[model samples]
Target: MSSGSNSARRVASLLRPSIIDSGVCRSCQETIGRRSYATATPAATESTTTPPVVTPAYTINAGVVLSRPPQITRELEPFEKAFFFYQKRLNERLALPFTKYFYFKRGTPADEDWKKKIQERRTAARDIGKYNAYDSDAWNDELLLGAEQSEPANQVEALVQDAESTANATSQDTSKKEDIPRPYPRITEADQKNDQKSLNRLLSRTLYLLVQSKEGNWKFPTSPVETGETLRLAAERTLSESAGVNMNTWMVGYHPVGWHKFNAPRAKKGETAKPDASGSKVFFLKSRIMAGQADLSINTQNLKDFKWLAKEELPQYLNTQYYSNIKNMLADR
Candidate 1:
């Protein structure tokens, strides 16, 4: 024990200068002989806690505007120039400028005077060497400022003669249904705006006279104006529901023009049919179609097929009075 104590004192004395007296503190000196002083480190008695992680540095500047983010989920259907016809005048009337189209049902009054006006216009177009233009591509930008041409006097004799014959027939038989005069001349009318692509992929706006199907159908996509609805809204709803009009297809152009009226048979079922007096009035809204592939899947109306045709091509497909009605409203760009 005496020899071991003497050896420990000698080792402590040797470590005193370097571990305690020269640089190391008093606590290190006390541990020199008891434990190895090879490398200095924090004591084993230290806590088991981990150091906190630092975040990436960022600086917000003063006066930097922080706009609120847009709500993507609440995005609504767009209207007008916001979606189509990027180069149109604001507040300007939207005009597709269709050739006014109409057709008389069988047993309806046929006006020959109206026929003369249409023939005149067709002749005038041919006289001007615009026969090709009559069938060619156009933007329908024609400035038409005059009143519609009046029906000619030539048909007055024919109308009176027909009336006399009808009167004589009625006088002969009071039981005949045709003897009673109708409040309105039964007819059906439609706007015929045609859309098709030219050879160069240019969009064409030719007018067409669509033929009625075998069951007597083919009418414009239209509906009655609901209560508290504006004309524009009603037209929009009608076109959307009846024609599958989508935002990408057409742009609603202007306030509706005056309503077009036509007559029809009563909607009553399983009974003797009556005249639809006060006739059906359809409000027209001119619209520019951006493309042709319209979603024509109307579940409610009977529409079989459609095609776009120029006005010159309509003579073979349309009745004379109906063609006359269209010609009176026709203009050129």
Candidate 2:
């Protein structure tokens, strides 16, 4: 073969064809074509291309972003549709009909059977003298006296033995001689003068009754008793420091000391335990303002507000739950 032809053949062998016309190999094309008479379709000779479709990236409905198409129809089961309808109806009926129905059923008895049963039970039970009057014997005595007395008898004369006795016995229960009022405890002028020194000594030890304030969330002022200080001393100091008011007269009444106990969660074990809690003793001191004394200078920094309320109006202002103790204290005063 010529050198030019050989070079051309070698180049053709190295290059792969863009498409194959048949299943037969190019190297054994003539031999296969002769042996197999069957024909095969040829593959595509070049790359295929198609245009891309452009769809929306997003949709908006009433300013809300939507990434998918909205459904044209909602699919719900028969029972679900019925349940939704029933719920809507129930809500509407609840406004009036349901409440009325509840009250009607509660007020109206089921039948007359229950009422009949109740009446039968009541009749079967024993009759006790529950309505018997307490002063029946007294009324019988008056009636008997009326029959015996005939001295131009009036209603008053018949019921009573005499006008004085009737008035005393019925009005004031002063039938007993001891029921008469006694004279007040008297102090002679001489005794009073002699005991003036002793009275002054007793008054010096007396503590005053003062309240701090009950404003801006009511809270009682309290202070721990200092060394060598008594409970009375602590109360006096607390009142003085908080309200700037000094008390000279200690109240002569048994003041109630309210106490309470509560359980709080323990920090270490995550459990609750009872802790002792107690309230200060509230004293009812019957006191008068000292002559020429100025208005109390309240420590506004500690107490938000302060007032000296009258004893009579205290009940209306005080908490009803704590009124019992306060009332007893005031009563004693």
Tell me, by lDDT, which candidate is best: 1
| CA RMSD, predictions in order | 30.1, 36.2
Q: Write the per-residue lDDT of candidate 1 for residues 136-184, one digit (tens) a residue.
A: 3333323223212111121233344445544765585766544334332
Q: What is the lDDT of candidate 1?
A: 0.40
lDDT, model 2: 0.35
Which residue pairs in model 2 clash with each other?
none
The residue-level lDDT of candidate 2 at 24 comes to 45
In angstroms, the error of model 1 at 49 is 96
Worst 10 residues of 1 by lDDT: 59-68
The per-candidate count of clashes, in order, stands at: 0, 0
User: lDDT at 11 for candidate 2?
Assistant: 79
Which TM-score value belongs to model 2? 0.25
Determine which window of 10 residues in candidate 2 has minimal summed lDDT.
60-69
